[model samples]
Target: MDLEGLLGPQHPVAAAALISPAGVTVASRGADLDADFEIGSISKAVTGLLYADALERGEIRRESTLGELLPLGDVPAARVTLASLTQHRSGLPGLPRSARPLRRAIALWRHGTNPYGDNLEQLLTQARKVRVGRPRTRYSNFGFELLGHALAGAAGRSYGRLLHERVIDPLGLDHFYLPKAVDQLGPNALIGRNRRGEPRQPWTGEAIGPAGGIRSSVRGVARLVAALLDGSAAGIAALDPVAPFGKGARIGAGWITIEAEGRQITWHNGGTGGFRSWAGLDRDAGTGAVILSATSVSVDPFGLSLLTEHTRTVLNS
Candidate 1:
């Protein structure tokens, strides 16, 4: 793949990296491999790995309910299963029902401020007012936020601490981190630009960190992809598909698996107000790829193309 060419047009900053049995390569524009960018909902993929780890450690069970972990009161969300939440079949809305989501979205679009800045207590209070719907393959930020905190509660640690202890530390992903506030951001963190070329504030908050608030450098995510491919990452089982997501796609913990170029590709894409990210794996070929962009445009096609090319090369060889 023409990695440099692909990143050249990305607004402000973008980074792409690929890893195979041969090694890892990174190409970027407007930033180095160590510059952090908000990874958006790819945080769910991290949470998914944590969930799998929790299960393996016997800290939680698939049948565990939200009420068993979080103090969500007597609400429908409290009764949802951990399994359903992990696979996004929990029937919860993408955001808390009580959070006035439309207003928050309007604020985000008009002001470019963080709409998901609610703290954990606020998140729990909002969850108490939620009404669960029929099980389906809907994506739910609300569900993941709750699931991550629940996992943390089960492990007797905060989400950030738990992530560091279980995943980041072991993987040696130096620039991977969850910043609960803007001040926590590193000096090298890249400020994202909206599609209109306007600068936007970083999306950071303890409540939403698990769903869309983690940040990482190209090197950090590339290292993670390498770990996932080599079975050295915790919760490798999270990559296994457990349910039908959309047409011709299956959902795992937070990973999505689809057949492309005659290969089963497992991947996830994320978007916040001003950033877009994609990560994918061609497990059979022992190859993985990631794309992080400052603009909110979708990079899914580029990421898939890279992975498919790697798979095709392996098959031909």
Candidate 2:
């Protein structure tokens, strides 16, 4: 499909896997998968799954208020719930405006200048000032970050530790972790470059790991998608057409739904610095694809179009 031409070889690494209800599977770029790309917002789906598991285990209630789980101190964050947080209807800004000088934000947190201890409080404060949208749809990273903090608080652990214990270990996804320090990142980690093709320094956000910081291999992501599509996981089930938000272009828990060329596709895309990734599962046909790139460009639309066209051809055959 000329993927290499479309996305430079140094910037593109694509993986696809087709799953069947009878447990049959086929994969490309599956065996040797890249494990160290910054997965961006796709981490939200994983975080959502963790929260779903917590709900199932009674560790936390989906309807539980944020204020009940953490110390919001006069902040209207109490009005937000786990569901709202995942759904991005928590009235939070996309991110803190003060976070412009990303390095300074990191320094402030490192020096313990802010006790909510990160930009999370700043996000919540912005949310309080804004109008909460209707419960169904809106995209906000601020809300997801709040959800991360709330989940960690409820579980009595740090966000990274909770993700490891509840999601990664259980799923046997050994290759993923939220980097505590930039130096801990692997040698193969993708470097972000600007549109001008200038290398950009590695940037870290304060305490917003849950919102968009998860790294994974192409095959590892496929396994997770397979589990979800087959309903093999305890708390996760395949996309239900009758769910609250319609099947396409909707957010359920953490997954984004899309209907492409007659296939019901549930997917998520993530990007950070010099890395971009797209992961999707076609529920009706029981197939999925994952694309991981070391560039900041939007590769999901192209990948999705290719996967959708290929799946259609096969189904017609």
Candidate 3:
């Protein structure tokens, strides 16, 4: 499954890194192993890990209600819980109606003055208007956004600060950060492009920072998967099959579950504007892979197949 030409003439820069459970990087691409990229929704996995860590430390309880933490005031869906948010069972709309308006505000802010502060408030107002769905499986970005806010409130710190203190700092993942502003990104950091090969301006993603704002490299993500495969003091753990929700499909905290070659595949994919990334771990074989690309093209099947094949080859050898 070759994806070298999938993006056509744009030729997106991509990096794939596979690692053993023992923390050895077995494969990689692009610059130094520690270089960073806009990792998109893979941030969800990190957020999940933070929640899990907080649960372990008794800083927050999974059963805690969102209303207790965020106090949605008059939002009818305030009954959501932390567990429901992480499991995508909250039923909130995937993207709020304010997304486009916020994006437009970000564009204008980039032109000269800052407009994202007002847009973020507008986004929160729009979010409160969202009606909850029946408790069921539906991918909702707003659910995670609420979780981020709730987690911050519970920890008594900002979301970015909490992430740094609990996850990145402990793991020694110096290259990863949730940028509060567009200028924080490195000049050489890869830019995302549309299907037509046009460069898209960087948008201030403050409104959805927790759901999809993380930036890291293939090597950094691979190291994270490595930690998950081998329980580390840094709080990473192997994928647990126990259904946190009812007896449904296997999903561990934040990572989705799939089966390949009779092995449990725990993985997540993320996309924002011009970037897409996928990361996974085969818990049965103690191997993991991370794929980062500078475009929004789907890379899941390719990343999964590569990880599965590579793990099989290495184990058989």
Candidate 4:
């Protein structure tokens, strides 16, 4: 497959790359393997890595709950297992009930307002008041926000610092970082664009960093992906499929695996007000790709197609 031709000049993605399992850059555009892009919900995978490492170190057990790590009390969701949070079966809503998401959605559609601004303290307070629904597989950014803090508290550090020490630095991913403030989203950070060509606000608030605030270049992501395949990452075991979620889908610590085209593809995609991202690898085929679109267009198909195509390339190479 023509990976470069696939990422033509007209694609909404400002920066993208195809990386080999040997940590070599196979193809790229708009930016090299080093420029930063907001990784969106891919941050959840980082949190998943932390959770897994914590378990390996005996810092926390797989079944550890928020209440055990923090002062979250007996809130139903607080008692959810770390594994459940990683797998998104914590029964926690996608957002805090206090968020009034219906209104937030309207605001986002009309004014492009960021729905997430609550600081860590406010988020924790809201989590205490949240009424979790029945136990089932439900994707929840709020649940991950809480899980990030809970893991940090247990480790006597902050989420950003823990992630740096445990995942980023160890993997030699120097380009990956959490944007702590608007200023942190500097020139290197790709400006996400709405459909109308208007720049969207950078998602940089502290409360949601663990869920969606990470920024990295395709190269950094490629390095991380390579590490995941090589077992060089301390938390690579987090990629193990542990719980079933949807038809032909299974959940790992922070990764999701789906059966497609006769291969089990482990992947995760992220989106924000203006940007979209897809990162995945086909272990059996030994190929992976990173698709980062500056516009909020879904790129899951492109990413998967790229991986499927890569399988053919590996066979021929």
Best by lDDT: 1
Q: What is model 1's C-alpha RMSD?
A: 1.2
Q: lDDT per residue, candidate 3, 1-317, as tens digits? A: 23354323333567777777545553333344455667777887788887887787787876887777765676766777888778787777776565564765466434422222323455567667777778887777777877876788788887889888887777777467777677877644666665555555543456567787788866667767777777763435314544543443566666788778787788899876667789988877888887777766777877788788879877987
What's model 1's TM-score? Answer: 0.97
The lDDT ranking, best first, is 1, 4, 3, 2
Candidate 1 C-alpha lDDT tens digits along 211-256: 9889999899999999999999999999999889989999888988
RMSD values for the candidates in order, in angstroms, are 1.2, 5.3, 4.2, 1.9
- Which of candidates 1 and 3 reaches a greater lDDT? 1
Error of 1 at 50 (Å): 0.5
Measured against the true structure, the TM-scores of the candidates, in listed sequence, are 0.97, 0.79, 0.85, 0.93
Each prediction's whole-model lDDT (CA) = 0.89, 0.65, 0.70, 0.80
Please report the TM-score between candidate 3 and the true structure: 0.85
lDDT of 4 by residue, 1-317 (tens): 24457655444455555656555454456555455777899999878888888888889998788889877787776787777889888888998668787898787778777777768888888888998887798899988998888889889998888988898888888578887787776567777777676777777777898899898887788888888777788777778898897887988888999988888899999998888888998887667788877777777888888877776777678
Candidates 3 and 4 compared: the better one by lDDT is: 4
TM-score of 2: 0.79
